[model samples]
Target: MTASRLPQFSGKTGRPELMVILGSTLTVIAILGIVTFLLIREHAGAKETATRSATTIAQLIDADVLRTVELYDMTLQGLIAAAQRDDLRQVSPQIRHLVLFDRSTTARFKGDILLLDKHGEVLADSSLIEPRPGNFADRDYFQAHVTNTGSGMYISRPFKPRCDCEDSNEWRISFSRRIASSTGEFLGVAVASMRLTYFDQLFNSLYIGSDSTLNIIDDAGILLAQKPYLEHDSIGKSFATRPNVVRILREGSGSFESVSSIDGRQRLYTFSRVGNLPLTVIVALSGNDVFAAWRRTALVISGATGVLCIGLLWLSWLLCRELRLRHQAEQELAQLAATDSLTGVANRRILDLTLRHEWFRAQRSGQPLSVLMIDADHFKAFNDRHGHQGGDEALRTIAKVIAANVRRPADLVARYGGEEFSVILAETDSTGARQIAEKIRMAVQQLPKTEGDELPMTVSIGISTWTTQTDVTLEQLLFAADKALYQAKEQGRNRVVAGS
Candidate 1:
């Protein structure tokens, strides 16, 4: 047997086939490396463009808001001066008469002017609204002026008020300031309420692009004003459920890619927080629009890469084809391992990697952390009613909704299971977590349900807040939220319930 050993197929040291194989492998790697570099450059350029656009828009809007605030301040000061001298009575009618007597005057003042007392009671008003002389005492603006001495000038939250002229409907945004006497004693609050329709018009005129939107949220994350005005409960509703907005408010500024709330288009958003104000300005640009140039560049680079690859293959056709196939197969395997085929989100393996990374980050920063366990209410029923296809569609829709609402870059939205989703709300407290849960409820309700469904689609959300003192494991936090989700279902569906 030893004498009959077959000859091995080992090639000579300088064999042409071995040289061709090595040369082709190196060429392919170099081509791939060049393509990757170009892609990275394109991505960076797109990001820079987006950031610049967002910053410019934010600054312009900030200027307008500040100007409005200043105007309100000046108007209040003028009113206060007149009220203090008891000259408002003498100035208006007297001035009108004088002007009329001067013969050259064709203009007349078109707006009503009112003077409010310390408690927001209208002491004197030119327009003569009924129940007026003492009507506004209970108004929020008036109350704010009376109580907060430091509040020099205040803009009231939007509200709808009954019209004195029975046929008219007027909803207004009020601006107010405390009137102080010579010795600094509070005299009264001077208020002016402008119809919100006009404000809406002004905001609408400041468009960035086709689908761009502007919203003004108050300190409580309440939507005080928007370009295309929405109705009653919709106006003051909190967006706490929107994790992205929540993140901006908490962290001051951030950017992310997500689905738009208004148009349902994919977009890259950049948010800037207004200085010394409970306001955040968000500028969103469509992903395609923002990265159009980069995409074009990518296409060009890809074409070049293809050409280069073909040239290399042609040069080494006799030897290197098998090696290229093997390399491609490895890449495919790696991509598959990292991706979740069902939801198209990161798979459980990736999630574990993320959790460990975020855990260490929180530990180093000493910040509060929270988690939300979200379960679709009656999801099994949905599966039964619509079949697996329908269920899959519903899951995708819910995922999109959740993704749209997350406010922070660090926040994670994941499909935890068949009918469950989870969110990691960083640096959040219990109160904040509860508010976020409610927002999720509202957003789900707002989704259009399919025809013939007895109950509209809804979710049961469980939230748990974490702190350094808690000594609780991440698993424990998940368990708490899960328990809370069950409680929410037990209490009836479509609601948020928080765990201790």
Candidate 2:
């Protein structure tokens, strides 16, 4: 009942099974590697995408700020062009009002356009108070324009507008140009006060987060205007000392990651100098907000990877199961093929295979291989006297006797054919083969009988042996043993004959 053949292959599965496990393990490793690579790529891609998007936003807003400042300067340029008239000092007050307030209807203008007289006195104002109340000089833009009549459109740093009419705490930057005579004598300064709300209203529509920032600063990094304006004194505050501003100045326009000097938050910063103006526009995005979109993408990718890992594991299990079952069935089929149904000994198919394998082993070891060819003596006569049942029983008895006499694990006894048997002895010489052949012959001579005739049974055996040094092939060895068997039958029925 025990599976002796099965035990030979027990603890270890075959090469195909090993390959399944090895291949599966490697596949899992490769999957993990791919996931790692994907995650790294996704991380880099997400950061890059965030940086580019921020830069685009910055560029768009930079264009808006540039246009706003340029328009203010263009108004000053128009005023200065009008002052070139020779008889302008003699023009009617009505005509002068037409010249000063010509650009007032535009809603984009959040500040007053003023014309100053000699020594920075506010002569005519765009806001149109009958006797315009303030401003005799001293602003940087005023000083710059008075000193150099040719100074083209000067933009001053962030400052509070000096006015007496309807006043507020709000700040505005000034854009100024000089009004001069044909001989280059400074007549006065024409000024435009750029309202802070201009920049705020422009940036308010954007959805940058609380910690995020949108600001425009002069070349000296003085805060010109900012959205979500600082409750503290950020207006007129200098940021030129910060490293981020220095880098922006050096690069002119680019995106980078940096820590904020104000909020101390890490941000992806996109900045550019506003179109030939001394102003720089900045858009800063918080780190958490920048990575938020990437987190969602990574979650989806991880979910898919988790599902794939499970699927791969399941596939490996199923494959190994199927392969193991098929391997077991093949092993069982091989066992059946090599075993004899009637005698329980090796059949002729196995005998041939075992002899070939042993022959090669003996050759390699430089040892002698011996074969015993046994035939049941007078088997046909016994079958004729007692029917086939009795004959079959006699054959069974002889098989058991042959099997019992061969003791070594390396020795094999097989039913070679009808009434013919064989024994293959490994590492055996002629004398050893002859002795075992005689023992099997005597054992067959004493087969027990519980029925019909009580006639004694015997087997005539022929022995053959060869060493690698001998000129004998496996076929030649087999032929010599068969010939010796015929001779044993010729001389007597129950003896052994050995062939050289």
Candidate 3:
């Protein structure tokens, strides 16, 4: 026969706690993911904004530099046209000088304009009525024109004049055109020089960040001018080997990020080639400046996000703790509700519930269900002699004995009211029920006597079993057990009796 099992609530308290932790974790992760995605997108936007701003500055420089170079080229072309005229030789020296230099635009940084003959001798000077006795055969611009007649509009690397004049120490670059005969023989060169101060003037007017720089370089990778120069005498120096410069020159025009060869600080380099000329304009914006605002914003936002996530987890922990405590309290309440207050055994209500449940199960499985109705022998006279306290004590002792003898978990011992008690034994027939009843009677009979007691305490038990063939209802089963208990009392106290 299969014994019935009691209800249990063990190991089921953590389900709500697990759900709370899992939900909070998922919520925190989702928040972090969204915040991180937003931050990354904002960082990209900051970089793009910086790039566009740099490109704009570079284009502005390109336009201004192209315009200035065009002016110099025009002056060189006019000087060449005048120098090639035989009619100008017959003119007066003053008129010849005026005619040759009339097209030159006067500017603060403008330098001497000279016409050189095939041998690099100064044939005319724009600043002087009579040409200075200066030889230019060694000059790069003069040498370039003489060596290659097709070296159209050669722009020379930065150089200083040989003289010790106050401004001669300043850096200067020359724009020169090859003066050729109709037969294509190189006759001489027309050259004009401009001081590097023109670039400083143009650069200083624009605002690129405090650490950033605006630069101009020749096609040969010679630095012509820089605003806020990185090093002393940086102008006229060759940057041909620098990785950043090489990329800028190779690509001709574009924007990129690279570490500056001078300071080793990263920068965003926006560059453009000045219209058909050998000059490139660059705007190098400091990386720190470009992303400074973004870094500050990210710091604040990340801190806030961290605090939010921590707070959420803390709240979840508190909620889980409360849920655990509540679950424990609920289980304790349920245990108390099912236990007898006086004997610490299954209460009467629980016994009834268990008996009814076992009855249906027994009926379906064809197993016998047994009930043992127990009574304290002479409980009225005993109570009159010992008072209610001693009687209660006797009842507690008898309940403990009955519970000890009924060892199976499916068996229940409960107070049936007054000095009466009851037991439910699952899967036990008449013979088994009678044997168990006799054992309960013997255990109560063996109890130690109290002071002033005439005899040892004892109990009389009556057994009733319901088999598949028995024609009895649940109420009839209980009535039969009660009737047998009366019979046991009538037979003699402390004896076990069985009912049909």
Q: lDDT tens digits, residues 332-402, model 3?
A: 78777777677677777777888888899998899999999999988898899989988888888887788
Off by over 4 Å in 3: 1-14, 106-108, 147-151, 331-500
- What lDDT score belongs to each candidate, Candidate 1 first? 0.68, 0.78, 0.87
User: What's model 2's overall lDDT?
Assistant: 0.78
Candidates in order, TM-scores: namely 0.53, 0.57, 0.67
Name the better of 1 and 2 by lDDT.
Answer: 2
468 Cα displacement, candidate 1 (Å): 79
For all the candidates, what are their Cα RMSDs to the real structure? 37.2, 8.7, 6.7
Cα-based lDDT at residue 103, candidate 1: 19
Report RMSD for candidate 1. Answer: 37.2
Best candidate, lDDT: 3
lDDT of candidate 2 over 1-500, digit per residue (tens):
11132113233445586787788778878987998898888878877987787777777887887777667767777766765555766878778777656664552645778888877777777767454667658788888877775667788876766555464567877788877776888888888787777777778877788767888888888887677764488878888889998898788888888888777878888888877877788888888888878788888888888788788878888988898898879777766777677766788887887888888898788999999999988889889988888888877877777777777777787889898988888999998888888888777776665356666777888888997667988999999999999999999879999976
Rate residue 299 of model 3 by lDDT: 98
How many angstroms is residue 149 displaced in model 1 relative to the true structure, after the best TM-score fit?
A: 2.0
